[model samples]
Target chain A: MSTTDTKRIVIEPVTRVEGHGKVTILLDEQKQVTEARFHIVEFRGFERFVQGRPFWEVPVIIQRLCGICPVSHHLCAAKAMDIIVGADKLTPTAEKMRRLMHYGQTLQSHALHFFHLVSPDLLLGFDADPKIRNVIGVIEKFPDLAVQGVMMRKYGQEVIKATSGKKIHGTGAIPGGINKNLSIEERDALLADIDQQMEWARGALKVARDYTVENLDKIASFGSFDSNHLSIVRQDGCLDLYDGNLRAIDAEGNSIFDQVAPKDYLNVIAEEVRNWSYMKFPFIKEIGPENGWYRVGPLARINTCDFIDTPEAEAARKEFMAVTDGKPNNITMAYHWARMIETLHSAEKIQELLNDPDLQGEDLLVTGERRDEAVAIVEAPRGTLFHHYKVNDQDQIVMANLIVSTTSNNEPMNRAVRKVAQDHIAGAAEITEGLLNRVEVAIRAYDPCLSCATHALGQMPLIVELYDADGGLIDKKVKG
Target chain B: MSETITFTIDGVKVQGAGGQTILQAAQDAGVYIPRLCAKEELSPFGSCRVCTVLVDGRPQTACTYPIAEDMIVESDSEQVAAIRRDIIDMLFVEGNHYCMFCETSGDCELQALAYRFGITAPKFPYMFPKREIDMSHPEIFIDRDRCILCARCVRASRDLDEKAVFQFVGRGPDKRIAVNAESRLVDTNIDVTDEAISICPVGALIRKKGSYAVPYGQRKYDHEPIGSDIEKARKAE
Candidate 1:
């Protein structure tokens, strides 16, 4: 085996992201850890493909990037399209509808990451039997909790479907505003589920809190690294997932940058291309990649925000912030904990939006003349996603640049993987699969969207429709 | 020549124009004929074969087969419906139709037809055949993987827009749509305002710079199924 001569370990296609990962762990001549690398191999070339297309279709087209959080891409592209359409401020109905839909979007994505992707490691132990180390396994272990998770995700999807027409890719988000109002029937249906989901969310918070407290030592040491954190917050420093001011907190939890607009992204954030991977390395221009690389998504949001606006999430945030001891929390495993707090916030936000009468208000859209250039940002379930466009006077898109959340987290994910590898793989007593599991746990902690990372020639998942005798849909089967 | 004709479809007496096809007669008589390429404005080009029906004991494309006297058409039978389902399934396998992430998903004719016939999964293995995507056209881009070789774009460009910019190249599995003007789409004198852009039944030929103008919930096909308007019109008649 090549394990002896070079002592380099190659774990191909890390499971549960399900595919498209190659972790290369290099060992020194003495078999001590030299360096570990996370290699992303998917490439869709979205930037190149969208070149000559009309900027108006980018929201719908680019939203096809990920099925899990298509709404994020849809909304972000819609915001950019809004700027292109010359909408300085959105209509009341449009703003509320987008906010409601985005909450559902974040809720469903976080539910998926926690229950389906990250739970097996938390509940069944990281080195648990590979057969039952999945969402299916969660069902076998804690049946009721798994059901709750499914219901929570269903709750999110149902809200999305009712408002957006479809959960995966609906035309709910248009430039300047949305295309439809949240009908009374749809709003009522979502409102009815709010109380039940709130209970489930509180349950999730308890579960996450218990686990984090119980395993603080192991969780802190396992994929832990001290670095900066970046997320968008409101002007008052409250958490704002949809629209906010950019905030960056250093290792000591001190503010390095604050309240920057999406247009000025070029000044602060820049990409460093590496030959080894298709994903770009994003960093703060002031510090450079060596120290500029910061974490995003749940942990970043939780660390940087002054307080969560919601009552329930605020309580959770207060408890979560205690772990930082006035500094940015870098315990990578705490991402799961931070995720549930945001989920609780989403559930509360969903209920709040449903109660508003303007959710069903009229004049959902507004149109205008074309703007030459625009950039839009939204905090996706993972992290901040950027969609920038340069359109011609004729309204044709000349060029497009996308900085998806997974790409932003590429450096940190690799660093976490490297940390786990250096610790577990060094002086290995024959390098068992259990040690390898530790490295995988690090990557999973970030809940990285590999499909969006490498953008591997964007695969179109195949689905066949089945209809009843009355020409009504009976079933649909999807295959990739 | 007779001014009108009568046809029996699924034991219902249907009335239509004398020279019209069975699909047209069925549609005129308030029956929905599942089709991908056959549009009202365009001349019937039976390329997709999705509108296949049992003409007596044999299968025929309803879009091309003219309605004759006492035509015993089995358009709604489980057997004929299965044939239509098979055709849709073939189309699904033959192209890179990823409806899950397609821009034209809900409003796409292929998808709407699939929904009408109740196709859950294609019987054939997905041939993820590599295809080219031309983003050269400033106003529009075509994803060849989603093209079903319906030739609607070709005909629409030539007949409607009167600019024969798109043409088909190759044959069999290798057959695909291509640009007639060399040096890519930008070199062609195609305009974004051309009516041909709306003629595409799939996500293949999409207008650039004008995406997601309509949100998902308020899209053309949301709430109502694809052919519901025709069915509703027939009911009103």
Candidate 2:
């Protein structure tokens, strides 16, 4: 087979994911897979965008980077500014309020990703007729599940509105502390539906768990590879999405580095910029770029942590780990199961926070000796997010370096794309809609937010193009 | 005391002193002409043409044009509304007015006027010109990007505060409010409690510590329109 006459397949703006991304797969003369690349097409330079802005405005202004995960950016930027303002220790009320907001963000984001983006592929079958493999198809086929997903997402959004003051681009989390406390009326309203939300979350978790268990043989090696897992975990080794120390584990569940302070993240991790992609490749410093690339988000978070804090999610985590005999579940599709476990955990955490009396406390802000530089990280819905800022004497942001979650998972996503391309599309006589969808299914497993990586807007159309080795287009497929 | 002058605004009779402008007479009659640069406590400055109304079949600023006995004024006509809406649109595209994150959003006069006129977005393309912020002052900061060049602060500082802390330093399009000092506001003698600091109709001048202190629905213009307080008096009369 002559590698010179390779056939190329390009999927521009992968659909159902946030932001714009394109996938290019190269095939040899025999149509065997040669290379696959996931390219983040748009770049808005959000890090440079924040420079010269006042440090206090970073939290609110940073939300423009991603519409889907605004709360994550809002809270992450606020945490960094909290240090700049010398609020080393937030009051209990402030801490809990921020946690509640973070959990709400996680629940809603994961719910939207699973029920809307992933279910179409799983329920309709990847090779199902392209016409019915859409939102209308999912609704027409699974009405009850569709309603549950919508209502669950709505409940999480309500929690966000109550804590952050609005559903979108909320200014709830501020430097030092929050601007307002949860009023009694707001608390009562959320409390009314907390139990129902918890029940729905459990039902969602079961859907993911049963699906993963039933199709274990089929999805076990579907775009799956052994890789390092990274996330933040409590000092006691419990899963903590809002606040924790950095941790990383190898494929065999051995701790590579445990309890690394977020402020000292630079020592252990570094990002590599490549000429081909707008997103950066983050990897462990010692292992270097080639092999150090690790997976993040739900699968990694579940793998790296000893146990989840919440009861039901912890039990679910145990069963999830048992699938791989207590080793890191490297099956790419297992991300869905891991994500649902977190969704259930977030719901339970929201319930617990709603019952606490400290939410009504008046002591919100706490300030002390201010620092000129600060670094903060929080587990966003996708993965670990890093926000670093340096302010001058006038409090204007002189420097900003943000490594969004999507950027951290860049290499892993590309690997997943390559694996899928090799398995399904490499030797095919002709590229079918179902085979192309298999590639999308692999990338969607990570739920990569290309918008956050490139700091672009939401909603992108899918365009698949096939070109000959001479760089001429041979076939095309388009979808929204 | 000046002699009383009578006028008809939008087919309604109104009275004012001889030296009073159409805006003054309209206010006395409980009609809001929607002037941004014209504050009750400060001298009227006709920089913002948002109050343009036809006086005797000619367009004139209600804030600057003096009222005369039996003079006819049309403020509610579609032509006048279009002019006001155009000025609002121009003000928006000419500056980097990000109301979503701005502190004085709900309470801002510019925002309220836009809301009242049903202008969700400007018609013209955004300039997005580079702008600078001055946070040298310990208590107050100036985000010049949001400035509409209304000059309310200039008049307030000169007339009410008696400090002359702010003034227009540049020409049209390049125009901006500058402090009394050579470059920075830190050198000026403006206090946090100065009437000029609180008189800004937009987020151009903001207090440092309290951005979004008030929650939604409780801010100054949240419950009603910006001029509803002045308009409510008309219904009572």
Candidate 3:
């Protein structure tokens, strides 16, 4: 449909969000911005496909949900399967090694977003030349910073490869525990890069500090809105991304919920299904969908947490808190800043877990009688990830429901896109590439890991006819 | 004479011993012909039919079709390529080949062929057929859903392993790979270290603890295409 007839602006295949998605802006009859939506159009039926599969195989199977965060899915599935496997508790070796692997994932993914995806928009002005507004331009201009980014990512990937197996779709996490333990050789290799990793992390924190200081006005107002925040935190309210009780805070940083068990997620959170997009809108159960939408990931973790345990990350958190005047930091651009701080925390945590002697222990796995149901949660780089499974007595999976990290931010991401569209394109007669980029910039700030809640359907019903050797009609497949 | 015969495969002259199949001669001459059930050590059963090539304008399996003098073969032509692609597509739909979560993914011949042919979404409908898995053997588990019905496991067992612990049962869609034992994997005579365990071309027969040992980047087909070795054979010339 042409804009002349419908007043619709569609940005098909949104860029830089880990996977394929699109943003659609609707204008009223008077040419005023009415609404905007970001849709994840690629549908994955992992839930349906995993049914009938044995619970022991779930970890490796579910890892295919997203190539960017396969480890996240791997860990979450394994933890849930841990319960299914009837483990009293994960052994010290298993728990610590999994933590190391998760931290490696967080560090690598966050570095990829900052250095590869978001830095171009920040280093270059948002309204800068569209042609030069990419990582290539960022490298062309800031060579040292670009190299540092690459090195930092390399450091994280090295940890992943060492702990798990490979950079993508490693099989470190298993049902009762991991299939293998971190070898002393691999541990020493990571320790060798510790100093370089810290230096790069500090440099990244400085870049974040400089960007925010330089662009205060833009950071404060662009896509800024009040909403609730969600994350997992320790009992003392320290930022604990790997394993902790669930916690949430209101827009004013008041505790909305705390110490919620991972198994009890259903009691506090609910999902709103929409036809336009397959990604479910997750919200606070008590508040209802109209006002319950909350944000997750780095900003939420930093803003809602009482403190970060690591010395350098704790210091960075304090500085960030002062910048936001404490509690509920809603400036979407500051997500980049919070991300850098979390990266530092991940690096420091990786060092701590690596230094622990238990990581090198020979106990790689444990087992017991299998249970029929299990639930597991972890803080993926995107946000809080939940994996729940129900299996029969035979250990065959009967049902599976996964609330991926990105699905939690679905409502807020869409709202940010709308806010950006309304703010930039409302008064303009024609929408330009710069304006479209603004909407993308707002969504990219969340760093959504897409494709978990995406599906496609063919429009205009068509019949596909298959022919045999003699050109005879053999079969017909139809879709609409 | 060195007791060798020469034939043209895809317009290239290839040499092999007498009674050698076209696939064998072509392979020695560095021509790659895709085959599923034609293992080097086993008898060529001509199963799966993925290695079909035109023998002077008539379609025949390159694995069983012996190379003869003055014969013209069209293996890589558009018509033959489409037929090969369709065969793979049908295999995808007929069985539950979920490569996304499969352990044998990077090393799977079917999956590698799909990647070589760029089979993003299959042309056929996903049957999601009701298939049974026999996890009876403690050392080896058989997932029938991912099986392509190739009897590499059967031959590897009977001839190489000499156990005769596996066989094919039924016909057409009802056809399946079966183990010697009736009840469970633990009842089988096969151990985790059997040659049959490593010989299966698919994820149907997998060693319990042998998966995920090789990382993604270091896997067999991670860096190069499956048939690239044959190409390398050609390139080394």
By DockQ, the best candidate is: 2
RMSD of each: 8.9, 1.8, 9.3
Once superposed on the true structure, which residue ranges of model 3 sit more than 4 Å away at CA?
A: A1-6, A455-480, B1-101, B104-141, B148-167, B172-174, B178-202, B206-237
Q: State, as a TM-score between 0 and 1, how close model 1 is to the true structure.
A: 0.80
Model 2 regions more than 4 Å off: A1-4
For model 3, the docking class works out as incorrect
Candidate 1 local lDDT, A1-480, one digit each (tens): 132334456666666663377676776656677778888877757788677555666777787767788898889988998898888789999988999989998888888888888888899998898677778889988998899888889989987886677877777878889878888888878888899999988888888889998999888888788989998889999999999868898988877899998889889998999898888999999899778988999999999999988999998898888877757788989998999999999999999999999888997777676688998888999998888899875556788898888888889988898888777878763656577778888988888888876555333332333232234443344433
Q: Write the per-residue lDDT of candidate 2 for residues A116-163, one digit (tens) a residue.
A: 989998889888887888777999999988888898888878888888
Residue A136 of model 1, lDDT score: 87
Model 1 has fnat of 0.50
Error of 3 at A3 (Å): 12
Between candidates 1 and 2, name the one with more favorable lDDT.
2
TM-score of chain B of 2: 0.97
Query: What TM-score would candidate 2 get against the native?
Result: 0.97
lDDT of 3 by residue, A203-301 (tens): 888898789878898768888889899998888888988878889999899888998988899999999999998789999998999999999999999
What tens digits encode model 1's per-residue C-alpha lDDT throughout B116-234?
77777888999889887777665788888899989888888889889988888898999999878884777776788876778899999888654555556456676777778778877
Ranking by DockQ: 2, 1, 3
